[model samples]
Target chain A: MKNTDKSAATARPAPGSCSPGPFSNAKGPDHRGQAFTRPGSGQCMKRNSILDAAARTFCRDGFTGTSIDLIAAEAGVSRQTIYNHYRDKEMLFGAVVDEIIGRMNAVLYGILATFPEKPDNLEADLVLFATRLGKNCMCNQDGEFLRKLIQAEGERYPELFAIWRENGPARVWSAIAARLARLAHCGALDIDDPDLAARQFMALINTDLQFCGMLGEKPTEKQIEDGARNGVRTFLRAFASRGNPSTKADPAVKPNMALF
Target chain B: MKNTDKSAATARPAPGSCSPGPFSNAKGPDHRGQAFTRPGSGQCMKRNSILDAAARTFCRDGFTGTSIDLIAAEAGVSRQTIYNHYRDKEMLFGAVVDEIIGRMNAVLYGILATFPEKPDNLEADLVLFATRLGKNCMCNQDGEFLRKLIQAEGERYPELFAIWRENGPARVWSAIAARLARLAHCGALDIDDPDLAARQFMALINTDLQFCGMLGEKPTEKQIEDGARNGVRTFLRAFASRGNPSTKADPAVKPNMALF
Candidate 1:
């Protein structure tokens, strides 16, 4: 859909267009300044455009299933133009991954920035973040594409999986872990290992929510939401430091007679 | 090395001995104990041989890269026999997956059977099970073979993924959940939802112990074991039905729960 609108606008032959090629009109000496007046901005825009097209194409046809010709056709650019931007097929795949990771980070961080000061508000915000992340991860179009991309080349191009780990799940996980750790330290929450805690929190969401649905089953929106809510509540109960510390003594801190 | 030894055994051609075929001269038609034998045991054995060969070839060369000839040769059977057993490439792939799932179940069940007692022995037994399962999941030849098999066919034959989930993880998970639920009912443990708890437990083991190393990072034996221990302990802490119940007393419980 995004592709169609952009392509329709770019499809117009310019006012005095001689050729249809993207470069043909922009190449001549008279049109050099007109072509890239804001060169840096244009470059970023073009790169993103290519990445969007690449994502759609890869999502549809898979890595081995897709070709450069298809990506170029979808992007409304010449094959040469694509090469000018990306080194090869593998490199282009890496770029597509990078763009997705960047978009996800942007969305998640935006949600993070909106986190409220009150604990109740923070829980609400975190749940919102989780919902958005899950939606993205399990979207029919994007999810299928990601599954193909990761499952197909994971063995041959193991580094791609590692890069995905570093960029996608791990990045968000670490951020969440850090926040949980800070909360724990501040006596706002109670956790021994934030990393492990974060993973369990995620595991709870995943169990009844997305993993089965990803296989083939379609779960209701209410079911997914209810599961997420239950998961967060359960996690917080196990980790929250809001309870009376005097009620249960720490098993490890028993009778420090020497200090006394 | 197994292949080398087997191939070396087959390399020698003798007049009285049949060369590398399903039947050897040493074993003739069964005259005795026919009633005890399964009706299609001969065909089943032959089918299994082909599947074993297909698994080996697929692991080494991937689905697209492996050929029927290689599979046939490795199985010590003719190409026609393989084709007769499996109608097409996809069927052969499916058969291979079926065999792998069959083998995994056998191993997993065998291990689980060793400790039939309930409650106290379970934790120790679980540690042993994790060690074995982790080795199966993340170490050595069979693990690599399984990884390659899943990676190669997961996208192309996603139903294969379903089979894996159903036969492998889902089956084991449900069994564990039921066991834990029984323990909880007996007042030995505490848990609200056994299903969710089971998923959290498996995910904990998978993420902390096996997943990273399985994807290609080199983790030592000690590291894997340590990670597994920590994951299991954390999971137990999260879901163990102990002093605290899933009541309104949990301060972490939010009024508005967000479902992802």
Candidate 2:
């Protein structure tokens, strides 16, 4: 069975699990898996450690719902350490958004990397791509974290919406658009405007799958996989250029725009 | 010149203005050149008047920004009248959303009616149709109101999104999809999934024009009209199976999909 354990620090095995080498001392018991920890002076490392803990806590509880004392206690540090890093609650909340968006991008990019640069079969390529996207969107706890972050920040800090637009969806859109453009250029697909095509494909997936998942109705893993395959099939059929011996071909179809 | 006047009610008939007819009597005296007078006396008439005013106010100010008192004053009715009609703020908001959506649909349908049902020149038909749509999105205040409504209510009330999905964009999509399907059936266009093509066309317009307008950084009206025309042009060239003899001669390549 697949492990769904969420403790980010220890989600993977010890360094020895793969093949322990010269860096084994770094993976010692005091490692604690804290991202903020540094090798030199312990003071700065301790400050970041508190910030990391605060982020996890705020992800679970909202800005108003969480207290500095709780964050301090969870981080195994004093409340003064958190105050040293962040001036107040608002500042801390901003930090949390930054951290969440960064983590989400990392996870998304990791999944997207699974697809080949150019695949032999269009259908197989699309199915593989969509399946990965669907799985990450639904099963990943970080997806919930991003959703809750948007919901909470949208209420209090409206500017976070603009930040999210720039970093989150906009970034993802550009990445997808580039991939589509590459495919269109290689004659894998007959697309006049790659960016527009990419947006439509995304809308199809989000409308059919992600939106439903956001409604608190979780589909099984098999269901997600199947749904992705179907979506890709529909998309490819709509976009593929059918070779037909027909009448006058007014061939003025332009290539993908360079604006993206 | 386009009329830029803003009058609630007025006399001295404005040139280049369509007669609102009965609704004109309900407006203020400045534009129509008349004194303020109540048209009907019954409770139902009075209730409808209040609703009209509330709808106008909700269009101007958002749901949270508006209040019972402003609505009452605008309708020339007491606050008790509003309470009598709507149970609470949420009910009033829902009614306003419905009213605005109705008006939007009316405008879009009116524009569609101006075009021939089946134009001999499909390119000209699409250009004209898209020009009209671009005008509504870029040149009118309705687009701004729509963006606000979507941004404000999209989170708390998914029903609002559903309404737009089902009635506004969805209807337009189905209209285009049906046309594509008919063309495919007649072997005029090489399409497998007309619905997906329709969605893709809509997505092109939305991302290129609607998104810019919503962001309040829109290009000039002429730019929008031209952009939309180009979008339709590219879409047709890419999807229409009209004169590609090479595509039909290939036995190895499957024609996209055979759903249509």
Candidate 3:
């Protein structure tokens, strides 16, 4: 079987094995001298390791300078194994990008799930939410790697990055916008455009962090927390509904309310 | 005289020239069998062309992949000429970065000068200001080239990029903050921290434009204009002083003034 296609079949026991019991698929030798266990686990492990090593190398050396042999060496795999999984360097690079994007999207959706659906205190909840988004999404390894790769090679591989543009920022913005729309619908925010507000919210959170992030400096937890608090405060200042009496009194003092 | 050092001296006319008049420094043969003209004009032209060529090559091929011979060839100069102008490839890279940063700073300061110091209409003035900022500073060739270089090579040369951090975003933020503080002092804005406000202001402007800019897509003038108007409206909504009655009535309608 081709190495790439072996991972497609569901995990199944060897044919004519022990009555299809729960332990039948357990990882051990079966009757027919084959291991009855997860299908393609070894191949998948090798693929993931190669992707991880490729990401590190690509981020450090950039695309034009990187070589498949270098990637194979870094990945501790043979050259034949790499070619077995990936057709070429370009395909390998695309796979690395796709893997990072997929991983980051999962983290992002996790952060988005924590958006304050029923915010008891809008500013405080937002600070927590923004903090999570910054730490877990923007400042994480995957995010930094993908950002650097795109900035470095986006011009060279416009089509590859267009996929990123669609799946990364476009989807992230839509999800955030939906949350803001719900908040506006609930009379918490007087937003004219949730789409713009979502973008502005991220912009505010990233303002102080942009230079540090660009230089690949990992921000302290305190820095992330302060940025989030400050960003959410500005956002609330601009969009808090006039009818929201709690925020109407004095907006500046609201964000400092023992949240950190 | 070394070609590089010849540009270091201030522009001056040849000594013992005819009457030392304005035309004495004009481009023509003078005393001492040498051309008497703007002292640094030729050197400056050569230096600019070298930097321009270096920037293009470094951005395309990256630092490691680029060579002095390649840059010299692209710039239509000899390898010895490059060595004469810059000590080595690293020095040439630094010069290219410095030139782009210097050019961008001039454009940025020019944009900062147009801040709504005395806004007859705050939203309209801000829209115009923001449009200028995006079109001139962020979207320009110098800005794009510098940004890509930094993202790609910032980690490779921390000290070099540290200089950029100090002069680039740091100086830009301070300049913008000074303007915002002045506006706040004049009761135009209700900003407690002009620094954060300045950062947030940029963030808002970059909200919609980030993806396109990162992907190396040049935004249309209309796109820039709309982004500015929308970004400024959100900024003003957050920071406009309570006493600014014009903005207080209906924030949505305030920004649509016929400034464009």
Candidate number of the best lDDT: 3
List residue ranges in candidate 1 displaced over 4 A: A1-62, A67-88, A111-125, A137-148, A158-163, A217-223, A242-260, B1-62, B65-88, B112-117, B137-165, B210-215, B218-220, B243-260
Candidate 1 per-residue lDDT, tens place, B1-260, comes to: 35545434433223113222221121322323222223454754555456666776676567766789877766656777676756677777765665556556666677555422455644445556665666655454445565555544555677666766566656666777787788678765667667666666666555554335433454556555655565555555555556433211312212111110
Candidate chain B TM-scores, in order: 0.59, 0.63, 0.72
| Superior by TM-score: candidate 1 or candidate 2 | 1
Q: Residue B14, candidate 1: how far off, in angstroms?
A: 29
lDDT of 1: 0.55
Worst 10 residues of 3 chain B by lDDT: B16-25
Model 3 lDDT, residue A243, Cα: 59
Candidate 1, residue A86: lDDT: 70
- Listed in order, the DockQ scores are 0.16, 0.06, 0.44
| Chain A fold similarity by TM-score, each prediction | 0.59, 0.62, 0.75
Give per-residue lDDT, candidate 2, residue B100.
53
Off by over 4 Å in 3: A1-46, A77-81, A214-216, A245-260, B1-47, B65-87, B214-216, B246-260
Q: Encode model 1's per-residue lDDT on A1-260: one tens digit a residue.
A: 35445434443222122211121123322312233233454554455545656776665455666788877766656676666667677777876765554445555566555433345444555566566656655443444455556644556666656765565566656777777787677676777767767766776565555445433454555555655665565565467665634123222111211111
Report the C-alpha displacement of residue A85, candidate 1, in angstroms. Answer: 7.2
State the displacement of the C-alpha of residue B188, model 2, in Å, after optimal TM-score superposition.
2.3
Clashing pairs in 1: A225-B259, B190-B241
How far out, in Å, is residue B206 in model 2? 2.3
Q: Which of the predicted structures, 1 or 3, would earn the higher DockQ when compared with the native?
A: 3
- lDDT order, best first, reads 3, 1, 2
Please provide, for model 3 over A128-216, each residue's C-alpha lDDT reduced to its tens digit, 9 standing for 90 to 100: 99989888878776777878888888777888777667777777777888989998998889887677778788888876678566545
